[model samples]
Target: MSETFVDLGFVTAPSGVVVLGMAGWIDYWREVGEPLSVRAGVAAKAGGGYLREEECEAVAVPAAADRPLAVRATTEPSMFDEEPTIATLEIELGLPWPEGVDGPVLLGDLPVDRSGMVIGDGVGLDAWTGQEDEPADGLGDVTFWGRYEEDAHARFGGERIPHPGGVDGVYGWLDVPMAEAVALEAEISTWRGGVWGQGVAGSVEPHVDYFRFRRAGLHHPLNVGAIEVGGCQVLGIDWCQGDHSVRHHGGRDWGQAFPVTLEADGTGGTVLRWTIPPYDEDEEG
Candidate 1:
């Protein structure tokens, strides 16, 4: 059996850095009976105020090239009252061990491989806010934010996938069978959201998290050889802390599939093209 490698890309909003968690902040604001606006600012003395912490752990598996890699992370709340903070992250790919190279080099704690290496740079956060004073469905003025990195440069054994405009949220490619790809697309298309019980809050008002699919409209799925691709417009809403909320609304078109190709040894797989947005306004039907 020969070796196989798949190219993957991921993007998400940078974690929020705050002195208090969302629940605590909302409670404090309610106690004061006022709305609050917080932003990240430079601190003169680092030891006194609350310090926000974000940590992410990811593992790349050579065997599972067909499914998205699961990443686990945690962000700690600030200990003291202070300005909000933000942290930037850089994602890199670890290559295989070289043919003649003697030793190894570490890419963040993971040992490098010999296949090849490529890095995606300038991936960061983007925020979206709802209309001022207009609460949707009686929730509250909402703000939704996440990460977007432009021009992800991905290469697997000399094959490349370039994101010229930009890639939103998190995206990647795996070399699974056609049936598995279709199943994955269906799972993503039907996701509505979930509920968070008092485990994080403790009150009867459970945090309601939901996203309305086909909010903009539905885009049908496509089957091309070994690849299956599909996506639709989505409006995601999260209501916590009694009335505070966040929403993610975006438009997606049926046309245009971001193409990805995987190669290992001397064998190549069918190019898988998946739909992504920031859609072209002119191309929307």
Candidate 2:
């Protein structure tokens, strides 16, 4: 259970830890819903990136070190400036997808222009440095569940949604076409306020550290905030369009949403899930 497709390239600092450079290359914009065709210079190395050499069409890596895991971050928007924010850090990858496919929808492709794609870091830029020194615990009791974008409905509740479309948390992939049977729906956004359970890092730990500084999914996606003063760093995108279905809610606790079972695996690819929730808590003091 270890698929591979390496093009080699990875670097995520600011403490969210996502660095894998025996080489380099990281330009993400691969969605698959209604924006299908994104594959921006995806290359990661150190041992095996590019999903470990495509792993038979899509099995990236990590088939049984756990499950379907290959989470990523650094959704570039020039990092960030003022409005449009979301992306503190997240990497919950168990890995698995491409073995008799079953309702696999996660797509996004309609924005391609990879500036030559060469996110270099041969140990140079300090590996895309970002850890100021430890000091980011703003979002107090964080919790922003899921299921939201029907049309967004103005982000419901307390409307303040900004960034890409202000819907929060989402990646890309989904274009099913063979033996089809898809039904993938993910509109669960969360980042409740107050620097919630802060823990920015860059991982490669002990050989592999599936960092779960819980405050969101492991249990911490409820209004997290705190940490501002010239803050800037937001990048969250999610989309899934037409025919999709997946089912595997048998063991990893899918009570509060976390059950993947994508079924249609061909001309229907789209299930983008990009996240970076760490809303700045200062700036205006």
Largest TM-score belongs to which candidate?
2
Stretches off by above 4 angstroms in model 2 are 1-99, 104-234, 237-257, 260-285
Tens-digit per-residue lDDT, 118-209, candidate 2: 12121222211122211232111212222432323344322222222224632222222212211111122222221224311111111000
TM-score of predicted model 2?
A: 0.17
**lDDT tens string, model 1, 8-125?**
2232212111111121122122234322212121210121122122211112111122233211111112122221111111121122222453322221221111111111111110
In model 1, how large is the Cα lDDT of residue 91?
A: 21
What is the lDDT for 236 in model 1? 21
- Separately for all candidates shown, the number of backbone clashes (residues 3 or more apart, or on different chains) is 14, 136
Root-mean-square deviation (CA) per prediction: 23.8, 21.5
Give the CA lDDT, 0 to 100, for residue 208 in model 2: 7
How high is the CA lDDT of each candidate model?
Answer: 0.19, 0.21
